[model samples]
Target: MRALRTGPLLAATVATIGVFLSLTGCSVAGDDRPVVMVSTNILGDVVGELVGDEAEVVTLMKPNADPHSFEISAQEGARLRSADLVVSNGLRLEEGLQQHLDAASAENVPSFVAGDAIEVLDYSEGDAAGNPDSHFWTDPARMIAVVDALEPVLAGLDGADSTVISERTADYRAQLETLDDEMSTAFAAIPDERRALVTNHHVFGYLADRFDFAVVGAVIPGGTTLAAPSASDLSDLVDAVDSSGVRTIFAESSSPDRLVQALASEADISVDVVQLYTESLSDADGGAPDYLTMMRVNAERIATGLST
Candidate 1:
């Protein structure tokens, strides 16, 4: 068994990683087909595109696992320890697995936080660095930041196979750009009056900002699923859904929709809790098997929900 010890540079890096992980998840892997452990399924999809068969990827959080509520199992701890590298989305989105990341760092393995690559949106009254809006992928443009981070890291890792990594990353990035255009066109079709979105929570702020939609409110009310909505919060959201003229409330495929439903009923608003793949992609057999497919599906759902 490999022992866990950290040198000064690695120590500092890990400490910095912890801060970002507090805001979201982090990931890392090795040069010769890194054993990449990502915090969420969505991230796994993106990494899959870059690493392809070169890396053995494991996503701890399942399709429906709540990022905040997900707990790493004892077996998963072993996996983290054994991984050659780890890659996670930085920013406190994966509240559940930060501890495991810490453990991996203690093992002197380098871990990465993808969110640190992008300029974060600070939604709080203060804290200019950003108040942890972990759902940046909702905006395809912001995801370009993720892909940018992804390409270089992947290139460095697969030195011998660097050509393939660079080419594939470029191709994937181009596709992301095309998807961004498609989303823009699809969203443009939504009437301005109906462009306001009411979702399960504030996951779509970046997406709304990207496509010119106003994010009214969320059913759960925050970035992580750690906090459930209070009765007042639900009532207020239902009222906001009514006042904002958003006839539908978007539900993340990963989170619960019952509360959103009850709130809509209480408000007597014709709110439809439409499911969209957000944090996690659909299962392998499902339509959204990768990051591109996942984002496209969400855009389609959002466009259709808002239009109809």
Candidate 2:
């Protein structure tokens, strides 16, 4: 009886030790994956899709957060510096996180700027006129360019499978091409007179440039959400809105729509305010969870809002 009890105790002890070692091994394995830190959620989604299971992507910005003003914690800053690669939207977009990015770069962390991949457009009519616009993801074609530039860089990372990255890149590029075609078709259906756009800020320069829509005006005076519109600026935009006969003004999901609504009210003509996912993506359950979905939703919303 004593020998039988002792044998079962020994088996139980060995099983407990094995389970603990297995758990510890899993943690180490996860940590072994290369860390790719991204500045914004939108690019984070893109990088995550490209890397798949080959790397661990840590996005600094949260869902539906403003890229212009979002800040990171100390731990996040540490991670950024320690990452094998860092990705950001350049052209002075991430005003809040610029310091941390610079710190990481100083530490010799490899970096990729999405803005460097595309033909940058200037803010034509705002306080930021002549400044390069950082909202290139507004146009699907531009995003395709970003994916093209990013593929080779991601493949070059140690521990990343170049073949897998290339395959995923091809698939994502196809989806972006399809999205561009669909947006073109939808925007084409709207009459030329009604294709004017007004927004809370200068967030849609790329989209307007791509789809042949005229930017009537913006409630805010600059390209960033951090800028506040003066009363004179609002008055000027209202006049522009009245003259352009812009029936719908699009507001960004990442920004407050109050200013947009106020602008619509101040306009001489009746205007409808529609919200778009312009800057950042939403949570998984939100309508614009991924980059592709976010663009699709915005395109449909713009088409419908302008059409009506």
Give one digit per residue, the lDDT tens place, for model 2 in 56-112. Answer: 899999999999999999999999999999999999999999999999999999999
TM-scores, all candidates, are 0.83, 0.93
Consecutive 10-residue window with the lowest summed lDDT within model 1: 121-130
Q: Candidate 1: deviation at residue 268, Å? A: 1.0
The parts of candidate 1 lying over 4 Å away from their true place are 1-32, 124-130, 158-160
Find the candidate with the highest lDDT and give its number: 2
What would the per-residue lDDT of candidate 1 be over residues 127-226, giving only the tens digit for each residue? 2124778778888888788888777666666323667777888888899899999989888899989988776667777787778888777767666666
The clash count for each model shown is 17, 0
Q: Could you tell me how far off, in angstroms, the CA of residue 57 lies in candidate 1 after the best superposition?
A: 2.2
